[model samples]
Target: MSIRDGGGTGEVAGRPRLAGPPTRLRAPPAASRPGVGRAAMPNAPPREFCTFYVAPPLLSPYFSVGGRACWEIKMRIARRAQRLAGTLAILVSVASATAAAGDADPDVYLLIGQSNMAGRAPIPDDAQGPLDRCVLLNDRDAWEPAANPLNRYSTIRKDLKMQKLGPGWGFAQALLAAAPKARIGLVVNARGGSRIEEWKKGTRFYNEAVRRAQAAMKAGTLRGVLWHQGESNATDPDYLDKLKQLVLDLRADLGKPDLPFVAGQVAKDSPVNAHLARLPQTVPGTACVSAEGLKTIDGTHFDTAGQLELGRRYAESINKLRRAE
Candidate 1:
């Protein structure tokens, strides 16, 4: 396999450089009402942790107030507190569970981009099998055994076949071989025929990727990301800018400021191959793998052999990055 880096200034056109420390999300205030001190509700739902609090009503009933009125006011406050407490309890439990799971050092990689990343190539009979050590984030938002066609949850295209060999399995296998003692998890979030513009911070596709990555992180450490796109935006001059922002946003969202990002070049005959090759020069903590000699089934999607090779190249790039660190 041949890998080439196009020489260009690190700066991306029409995009400002990210500066300062990464932004952190703050928890919501404990109390929304003034003079109403908040305290944790007692007997929160079983097995569920909660941060909910009961707030004393802003106004207290005077001694002269009617007994019924005072009782009614107290009941209302109690009911509201119960509901809020239940909701917060569930959230706290989930958060705690996620935190606990994320403490493990399982090696996790996120796969994102268009068709190639989603695995459009047909699977050969011999290669049709399961990886015992590989885990995938499946359609139901749960981690299960890694299977062929790594990305099967995408709603972007219904006509596309959901079952076919993809690079994710190969990539996972390569990772397992490199680190036999480490647990491997693959977060597949690619959509077919998606443009870079659709992968902006707030876009559905981008949010989904972030959500899946976050969930996957709960099960392992986010080591790197594998990207295979650009065919859709091959002609857009600002494609590099959009891609840069996407990478920056992903890093920020994943809370891994220096996460390794590996991008794969399109097929040798693709019009966007040149742009794809420039990823290393345009993005930091990133490298590009060449698909120069890969055999494509339809001049676009790689065949099973090509997919396996691509996965190996991605693993190699990631290993190189880890060593450099």
Candidate 2:
């Protein structure tokens, strides 16, 4: 008789259906039998050895022995999991401590002024000078290394023929060289060919600088404001008085009655006669630079060499003022 005559089988309609391959219901391998520990589990199925998944529930008392064995296996797995978690926590803590130690010191600086103080030099080749603590405020207003050796304000020359090298970058390098321990920051807001009229009491440029100065003062520190502009309003005879009023407004607005100001006299041989136009800002501070032989052949802007020297002169003036204070 067929095995199905005595044993019930799953049936579809009146025909009996096989319970699947007999091999599927065969007992586990001898190596996976009870009393075999983890030390002898090399030949066991992965599911029986690994604790990553839940085991099938044991419903019969015959399986009570299996249930007790499962409990012991689970305990060993839990202990190993706890040990791994603790190791991970310790590794994370150590990594954080190392990062914090490396960031113990930081540098900061502020750069503010007119077009000259905004930078107009060409990008220097091999400008890979070491900057231990210097940074530039990029065109996007993000802080980056001052390694470009050229400033964004210089891009104006493509449109405006009158643009030339200003003293901003030279000044920055000088400060970095003079105080390598300090961090540099630039807060530039200069308009090309802007006159005292445009920068006067009710105007935006002047007012904005004032507001920035106030904010800087609240922080109790401001490097200084470098002034390299004056040709635009030098033609006015009353430029001195207007400049004095401007100084008053700037100081009052910045909340510093005697804030340090750095000024540079124009180089004289300008083909455009821009040098002949001189305003009182030329003599505002005690450290005005003499631009006698430094004018470019064009009689307007400083050439590469002239601009570098101009920067040096400006830095010297600033150093003098700083030393006095």
On lDDT, the candidate that comes out on top is 1
Which structure among the candidates has the greatest TM-score?
1
Please, what is the whole-model Cα lDDT of each candidate in the order they appear? 0.65, 0.45
lDDT of 1 by residue, 70-93 (tens): 111011133456756654554464
Clashing residue pairs in candidate 1 are 50-89
Q: Which stretches of candidate 1 lie over 4 Å from their true place?
A: 1-105, 155-160
Go through the candidates in order and give the C-alpha RMSD of each one to the true structure: 19.3, 23.3
Clash count, candidate 1: 1
Pairs of residues clashing in candidate 2? 108-183, 109-185, 111-186, 111-187, 269-299, 270-299, 271-299
lDDT of each residue in 67-141, candidate 2, tens digit only: 111111111222355545643554464334334323312222233334444445543553445233444443433
- For model 2, give the RMSD to the true fold: 23.3
TM-score of each: 0.65, 0.56
